[model samples]
Target: MTFTLATWNINSVRLREELVCKLMTEEAPDVICLQECKSPVEKIPVERFQALGYTHMVARGQKGYNGVAILSRLPITDAGGRDFVQMGHARHVAARLDNGVTIHNFYIPAGGDEPDREVNEKFGQKLDFLTEMRDLFHADKPQRSILVGDLNIAPREDDVWDHKKLLKVVSHTPIEVEHLVETQGAGGWVDVTRADIPDGRLYSWWSYRAKEWDEADKGRRLDHIWATSDIASAGHGSRVLRAARGWTQPSDHAPVFATFDL
Candidate 1:
């Protein structure tokens, strides 16, 4: 089976429900994993999505806060979720496709303004979350699985607009990068986006803070798509829907896409 998947941090599902519908109506990815849904699972406006043919959903959500959800046109069964670091945030959710492929969607904590864990509690939680993720993947050694979402860390130099300038920044900090790299190594996961579009300044998130986000072009590759080594080679057509950032009442993050043939 061949399926196209997309990962996006929608910021708030209810706030940007129209944007979701627009994406479904236009691009029509087989599966869409959304992070930062910021609504209870029951209030995700599933009827709107179901009307668009994305009838299958597995989600973990909270009121006015972090949430993760997987919506698909293809059949999918809820594979469960995890409360990494016991943060009590609705941050992770998983589903299994009919082809025996599991999809993990995560909305990692944004590790506040200060990168120092000593000064920032959120920073500590973020590190702990990554550590738990690393340990989990190392023990299980995932196979034929894909992980996608706003991981909240841009590990590579080219993943940000100006790597040097952003090194001390939250998403581009060295310690965060190291933790993210360790987690990826643990799972032996392949970055499908980088694999397909190597050697470029690619970004999936442009801060709403920018007055003219497009011309200023200050962005980070916070959103990611990863597949276990076993089926990594089958992933292709990776791209960022950059224009979505300009949509009406848009989310700061854009959708990242990859197609896998299994």
Candidate 2:
């Protein structure tokens, strides 16, 4: 079986429900994993998405904060979620397709303006969350699985527009990058995005603060897609829907996509 999958930090699924429908109508990926939905599971506007043919969903949500959801045209079974660092945030969820492929969706903490954990409690939480992720995957080891979401860390120099300028910035800091590398290594996950498009300055997130985001192009590859070694070879066609970031009332992040043949 072959399927195309997309991961997006929708920011607020209810507020941008129309944009979600727009992408569903236009791109039509088989599955879409969403982060930061900011709505309780019952209020995700499922009827609207179902009208666009995304009939199956598995999600974890909070009333007006963090949330994660997977909407699919292909059938999938809920695979549960984990609250890393015991933050009790709706940051992770998983689903399994009939093809025996499990998809894990996550919304890692964005650390905060300051990178120093001593002064920023959120920064400390971010580091702790990542550490737990590394330990979980290290103990169990994933197989036939794909992990995707707004991981909130840009691990490569090329992933940011100005690597030197952003090194002190939250997402591109060396400590955060090291933590992300450890998490990926623990799972033996291959970064499907870089594996396919190995060069150039690729970005999925352009800050809303930019006066003209595209023209300024000060962006970072904060979102990601990764697959375990068992099916990493089957993953291909990685790309980011950059234009979506320019849409009316858009999310700072755009959708990242990949296809898998298994």
Candidate 3:
């Protein structure tokens, strides 16, 4: 059977529930991992999504801050949320599907604009978060696992619009990239997107600060889908729904998807 999984940072669930439903009906991913939900679990508008045929959900959310959720049509078990140093934010949520595949959704810190750890505390926290993640996952090294969400780091030069110009930028900086690489190496996680578009300018996120983000085309591939090496071979087609970024009242990021022939 072929299963499709998607990752998207909706920014806020209550505000974009309609758009989420629209995407669900249009794309029909078997599982959708979301980040930055910005709403409590009860306020996530679950009924609307359930009405659309998604009956299973595992989410960790705050009032209006960092949050992550997994919405699946298939049954999900072992639902758990990571505290990550008691940070008091809903940043990580994971579940195991009946197919025996585990899914982890994360919303790593944005690391602020400063890019300097001393100046920006968020940057320091972001690096520490990556370190913690590396340590946690490397211990077990899951085989039938998939990780997805807005990781907030662009690992390759081509993953950004202009790598040279954005070298100083937080998302594309050397330090951030190194941290992400370390995490990937620790977990032996193969980037599903890279399995297809090996070399090219691929981006999943655009800053809302732009007057015309599409015209500017200044974007960063902050979102990602990763699979354990054991099941990485199952990864086939991967795509980014770039046009969705232009939808009315759209979020700054678009949906990234990958299909696995399990």
TM-score of each: 0.99, 0.99, 0.98
- Cα lDDT of model 1 by residue, 1-262, tens digit: 9999999999999999999999999999999999999999999999999999999999999999999999999999999999999878999999999999999999999999999999999999999999999999999999889999999999999999999999999999999999999999999999999999999899999988997999999999999999999999999999999999999999999999999999
**RMSD, each candidate, Å?**
0.5, 0.6, 0.9
Q: How many backbone clashes does candidate 3 have?
A: 0
Candidate 2, poorest ten consecutive residues by summed lDDT: 207-216
Encode model 2's per-residue lDDT on 73-163: one tens digit a residue.
Answer: 9999999999899988999999999989999999999998999999999999999999999999999999999999999999999999999
1 or 3, greater by TM-score: 1
Clashing pairs in 2: none
lDDT of each: 0.96, 0.96, 0.91
TM-score, cand. 1 vs. native: 0.99
- Candidate 3 weakest ten by summed lDDT: 78-87
Query: What C-alpha lDDT, on a 0 to 100 scale, does residue 189 get in candidate 2?
Result: 98
